[model samples]
Target: MATAGKAVVAQQQTNLPFAYRQYSAAELKEALRKMYLIRRFEEGAEDAYMRGLIHGTMHLSIGQEASAVGICMPLSEDDQITSTHRGHGHCIAKGADVKRMFAEFFGKTTGYCKGRGGSMHIADVAKGNLGANGIVAGGIPIAVGAALSAKKLRTGKVVVSFFGDGANNEGAFHEALNMASIWSLPVVFVCENNGYGMSTSIERSTAVRSVADRAAAYGMPGVVVDGNNFSAVAEASQAALARARRGEGPTLIESKTYRYRGHSKSDRNRYRTKEEIEDWMTNRDPIALFEAELVELGIIDQAGIEAVREAVRKEIVEGIEFAKESPMPDMADRERYVYTEAA
Candidate 1:
């Protein structure tokens, strides 16, 4: 099978483009596929949004799939993760159901949040996903508390907190990192440095060149990886997860990725330049990077990658049909989840 993202990288090329540990061909291929699926799903949703099929603001993760899957694949079924507003990739990477996620966005009764939370607040506690929070940096402290509970219960489960580059500038970010360090909690802080925090560039928001460098203040391993490279993100994620599992405390992993979409669905993406987006779109795609690796290793072909893409596309298509047919929750039931009348 030929890869959908075919590239002609010679096997004997002397110079490598990025810094990452060597991995088996199979591992690289798998990570790339998951990231590809994530990217496709988000893009599909964006199309649906434009068609007025999906209600509410969606933070499409057209990029940053590597950070989500790379960190998530290392967790056990029992391990927990706290996600961000732009967290469909994280939820999917943690084995969340796409149909149900679609239902949630459509505000159907069968949604993970029971038709109320919509796109930014999808949650599946049973699957160890606490939830995707709308408030910036709100999920960080909650994840710390989850890790603390894991330690107290002796669950041997680690919590992964996924946040954006903008979140690192928040007060809760500093407070959670400090508390987690002092308590030696089993939490992995994954900072997806996607260049912009909402509409603001990272350069204007912070003084530090990388979020991983901030880990130094907390006495933890602060490592940065090319977030477009799935293998690099995965390897670094595994190392951080291993440290958390061993009670060696947490690691601040900064994945330098890019977002190919606007900060939200309505902004029209006026903040960034077309050339900047094109640079990543043409050359820095995560799927393309993995396809090149696959070809060089002689593990798979362009057809294989295309099949994967087609299968995911079919699933997305079916998800739309399912969501549209799904009955909206009874308006009578709307007031049930959030509060109850005084007895």
Candidate 2:
């Protein structure tokens, strides 16, 4: 009788939201930590940039934390991902060291690209990050090529292509999706529809109602998720990942999220009003929403949440300090990595 009752309880637990039921308390807490790290890291970078510590402009992903962390939840380090220009969140979520990222921003030799790639081209190949592309929809075709390699090599690895809604209109986007579907490759296309491609809004640019709608033309499953909600994004990612692993082909996921910052540091945000940005920041903040869910589910308490924040604060401070103290690449070695040397 006790065994039967326990089974019933287990079944009941499965009825909860996908993330709640699928992930353990520890995993969920870790996800929360990553989200916090992403938030703080960007904030720290912004501070440094304003203080003239970093060169070149950067694209901040302040309000899109949930979408990045959630989509990466079901992925392994062996699984590859292609990132965009505004990809610090994705890099951190996929297990990047914040210190190296800061070092890159500071143009130190300790950076992932030895201080050469800076903000837009961070890549950790051993961790399966194919690097962030500067071109719109650039990573989509690269991800398909990587997936093709994985399939041909019989590596059983999956590749995820992360792009913005702006990339949906690009010709490369259509071609990549079509190729992935026709070949039945193990790849997933994730569109982070933050409502704007720079200053242009989606309604003004895209003909389709949703970015996922275009996936049908490529003959793949089109899924739209509340990208601001961590659980919803993770659930969709998990399902899509499973499908890819089964050799069933690609899935296009349109994550409906928002970005609090402008398109880049240069953007004045004149395209949108203060009221709209304020509303999203105040009410639809991804970090706050995820924290609320964690507390409600008893996965973490207020004190625990604060502890995580405190830890992340310390880490961010240490990362900035490390970047400040690290040596910059010497001028004499400027052309060292530019060309390949003969064996």
Off by over 4 Å in 1: 1-30, 339-343
For model 2, state the Cα shift of residue 70 in Å.
Answer: 0.6
- C-alpha lDDT score of every prediction, in listed order: 0.84, 0.93
lDDT string, candidate 2, 89-113, tens digits: 9999999999999999999999989
Q: Estimate each model's TM-score.
A: 0.90, 0.96
Segments in model 2 whose C-alpha atoms lie over 4 Å from true places: 1-14
Backbone clashes per model, in order? 9, 0
lDDT of 1 at 296: 69
* Cα lDDT of model 1 by residue, 183-226, tens digit: 99999999988999878999999898889889999988899988
Q: How good is model 1 by TM-score?
A: 0.90
Q: What is the C-alpha RMSD of each candidate to the true structure, in Å?
A: 5.3, 3.2
